[model samples]
Target: MSGPRGSLVGQQLRVATTRFAHGGHAVARDDDGRVVFVRHALPAEVVQVRVTRGKAGDRFVFADVEAVETANPHRVTPPCQYAGPGGCGGCDLQHADLGYQRELKAQVVAEQLSRLAGIERDVLVEPVPGDVDGLRWRTRVEFAVDREGRAGLRPFHTRDVLPIDDCLIAAEPIIDSGVLRRRWPAQRAVDVIAPSGSGSAADSESDPGSDPGSHPGSPAAVLVPVPGGVKQAPEVTEHVASGPWSGDITVDARGFWQVHPGAASTFLDHVLGELDPQPGERALDLYAGVGLFARALADLVGDEGAVLAVESDERAVVAGERDTARVEQLEWRAERVEQALEPLIDGGDEVDLVVLDPPRAGAGAPVIRQIAQLSPRAIAYVACDPAALARDLATLADAGYELDTLRAFDAFPMTHHVECIAICRPSSAIRG
Candidate 1:
């Protein structure tokens, strides 16, 4: 409850949360017109907030709800015990109703688009098929290890770890893995992955010969060493099928894969629908993690056309190459997206379409400019963060690309995160 440097900490002020903002905070303005971002608060609620972070002469400060004077009707008790003040920093909107959380995310996305991109459109956040009321959807989770070898998650913006026996949003298999029951003395972190399938067992290097029946469908855990090499490395094969695209994807068990089971297929269907790839159209898939989108683009473009996939992670590229070997039309470039994009554009290859699924940072102005110079008829951008997407869309708009269609998905239920699919086309082509 103390601010940075223990100054201005514990200063309580009554304010009404006016609206939702990025990064899981609700916006409020003090009487002096200084901005205050209140956590664990909802829009339209009047609450007493205790300053948690601030500096002298600062225009804004971060605070936590000390007490709600007027609570929103949609606010519900968080399902997880370690989900409030001084609890784990995993889920931010757990206090809100599931449907309300999606609505808030949609509002955040729309606001970001309107403010940053100067574009306005009706935004509907459609829910993914899986998950039980926003519970048990995460297939993977990384737990931080304290100095005492206890496993837990870090508190928000702090190095302190709060021990937890179970995560409500984690898949059932991950909870059954008993990862929380064990200690990780030599490792600073541990990743538990529940691969798709039933009747599997938890496998860890610490307990090599452990029985599989200890917890049916238990996930596999890999130790992340603090200083030395990993004690045990694990790889997982993910099977995905969506909209004429079906295949098995190989990735490092600890690497980037959609935590939600239905996220990949759902995003793929939307991306493909937006791009509408032709049978013999050459395409580029930027930031192609494990070649998920690139594989689908290859299937659509056929052998006569080519699908080039560029990724920064070498391990991801290796796995992508191995998993996509059967698709001869697909090519993998193991380099940073910006670096690879320059040569592709300089080479003057006629790119018919571009599919980019950038990380949370999103592809910045430089990358967007290069893609625009390629003069592709259409570009499909899959963004996980709305603010980043808006910034990049503004750059694309400046480069003479117009937003054709946009769709948002409630990919990470019970959380502030939402996925957006944006389709853009060259203004000249649209005019023609």
Candidate 2:
């Protein structure tokens, strides 16, 4: 399958993969010494990869494993029919065993930390509770609608919708909702949410999954994009039982929440454990969504201490405020993290602990420097992308903070996504 080495856009090359890389690709060098990011292949396996993107002169060419001349011992038949080279792009490591999937994710995290942050650490991807086989854990699924009104998922690197009858990663209630069985005539996509709790009897009796508000936990269900504009989606009740905290938080279904069922509680446990909030200790929760961490911090801080939760989305702040009305110590500020940090920095406001769950991009240098000025006793950084986390950690290091403890979670199994929580402390605060 090898053609001229100068152009490899559509060429096929058999190469031996050396190691696993981020974004669900394996590392391999072609005959011409150009790096090939091969999908659907494992390390040390010789596979023929068909270049899907990039030309010869590029640093690396994207390719899909066309034929595996040699396969890894951990390779197993994919549970989903649509998980191979040309199938659905939702899952990346379905071919590998669940344990191996976690191993690969851990390697990615460690590699990113070592390369980007110069921090050499062995990362173990821990499985959240109730993750038996890395399937049926997704509480939220977005089904893309094809031109013919069929709901399905899209392939990677393209807008073409692949019609699928079922998504194995979705929770049982979502599939029971018969979302894929129906048709969307004029919609582009359908957003489905299945909360952890069970719906009420009336919600159960109604047309299940079709009506967003019909199910008890399934709030803002079946969000369809229409011409005139969709109505205000209803709020969903999510119960958190992490550590000593157990309470119900109401958030809009369309709002930002972890897609995995156990992700929120898992992250919360680690955050609370790392920060170890004490009474009369002030704290800050940046990019707080529905006050997940803020509420927990407020409870631990008691009446004398205050906790500020800043979020760019006003709606989220309003929802968080309404849900935590009794907590007088918690204050929700509807503004950007940068905007909130400016006032705190300018007024010489010092915080005892800081928990920031930044987006995939991670908190950049500006925000990292600003937070460093506060000089919190400890900072908990919850991140979805390891590369971004490593970069931000580097910035924090430059600002007199050292990487204390880092933990990675296999929250999004079968995919390249791995959640990481890094605890950074001021250099002088690190105990020998």
Candidate 3:
């Protein structure tokens, strides 16, 4: 049962308990009061392990479950191979059951409420779900071709590159394309863009010094299937391909975008379903990207309803305005959300619905307070990271808003990334 005499430095151990950490990692504690953050571990399992990152005063162990010593019903075989150690940060649920993933996401929401927002509820909106096939759905990938010119993602928890022959999450271009197969020890990293939707990748306008988007003819675009069924632009012939999570629908190769093309539709549909925009309503879309939600809301509002789409990115605002020119009900504005709302503070424009699609850092305190001051009847918050969402929710709740509906979209299936939506309203509307 012992492999070399596990010295005091190499104490043999078992994972005493495991708990969910933000970004889907499982934090386990060992007998030595040292923490063994075994990726994808479940609670109550005794695991055999080695130490990867540790110090003399404290010990951290790494476990290779040679045997389950004990098992939890919540554990399941991971759906993706890169889900565990030495795997992509894309997914952390290989050892966790799917049902549990849903619950865990929901729990993270609930915990955020009590711990951050302070509105403990018996139930939350049923978490939106779809079948697996997590990786293959990604419509865009920005590969890092190291100085060696091999393309792939940064290694888990480090900057080292893992030269990949194929990425399960990447679209067809990244897989079969000759970009990664070539050699280029001359450069540090190069990006490869893939096409989204039914269109071919558009030629890229790249900065000369950048890696993947370095050339003007780079074929790539992060596909964004706008809600209520907006088709890809027919004349749009160019796309700037860049990196994962960076180029979903940006004019340039680098900007924040919702990753995972495979799950983009399912995720968008879920958000639309939850928001359920009504006609003749005035809506405010904050942090609005190249008008994804703005255009979608435009369709629902029709001629009678109006949507004010606000985005910080001047490029995205211009793109969204141009992209959704057909929608008369939408007005796109390029301005930081916090400053843009200054006029509304005095009760000038009271919107029926307010949607916040903030970055991982989330809406800071000022933004949260303004949302409350504006007092929109319904606020749909699309958050890419849970912890940030939780922190913001706490701020909103303290202002007397309650979480009416909360749902999670598994847009990034293989990686550790998860997106969530929270619908908040006055406590009077609290169902239970």
| TM-scores for candidates 1 onward, in order | 0.93, 0.93, 0.75
Clashing pairs in 1: none
| Better by lDDT, candidate 3 or 1 | 1
Q: What lDDT score goes with residue 110 in model 3?
A: 59
TM-score of 1: 0.93
Residue ranges of candidate 1 with Cα displaced over 4 Å: 1-6, 197-205, 211-214, 217-232, 429-432
lDDT of 1 at 90: 83
lDDT: the better of candidates 1 and 2: 2
Clashes of each: 0, 2, 21
Q: Which candidate comes out best when scored by lDDT?
A: 2
Error of 1 at 174 (Å): 0.4
Name model 2 segments beyond 4 Å from true: 1-7, 198-231
Pairs in clash, predicted candidate 2: 199-216, 212-221
lDDT assessment of candidate 3: 0.61
Specify the poorest-scoring 10-residue window by lDDT in model 1.
Answer: 219-228
Per-residue alpha-carbon lDDT of model 1 for 1-432, expressed as tens digits? 335664666788899899999989999987778899999999999999988888656789899888888999999999999897778888889989998998899899999999999989778898887798899998888888887777899888998888889899988877786678877676677777776632223354455666532454543432333324654345677778888688778877767888898989888887888788899899999998898889999989998999999998888999888877788999999998889888877898669899998899999999999999888999999999999999999999999998888889887887789989999999887677
For candidate 2, write residues 338-385 as lDDT tens digits: 988998999998999999999999989999999999989999999999
Query: Candidate 3 regions off by >4 Å?
Result: 1-14, 32-35, 50-83, 87-89, 95-100, 121-132, 198-254, 262-264, 267-276, 326-328
**Model 3, range 1-432, lDDT digits (tens) per residue?**
323444333445566555655555456776557666665566666666555445455455454343466777887776555456565554566567555666666666556656766567543323223333444555446555565555566655677777766666565555554555555444445444454532333332222233332223434433221122323322222222221111224343334455454344544565566667888988888998766666666777779999988888886787677766777899987889988889888756677788888888999888999888877778888888777887888788788787777766666554446677788888777754
How much lDDT does each candidate structure score? 0.83, 0.85, 0.61
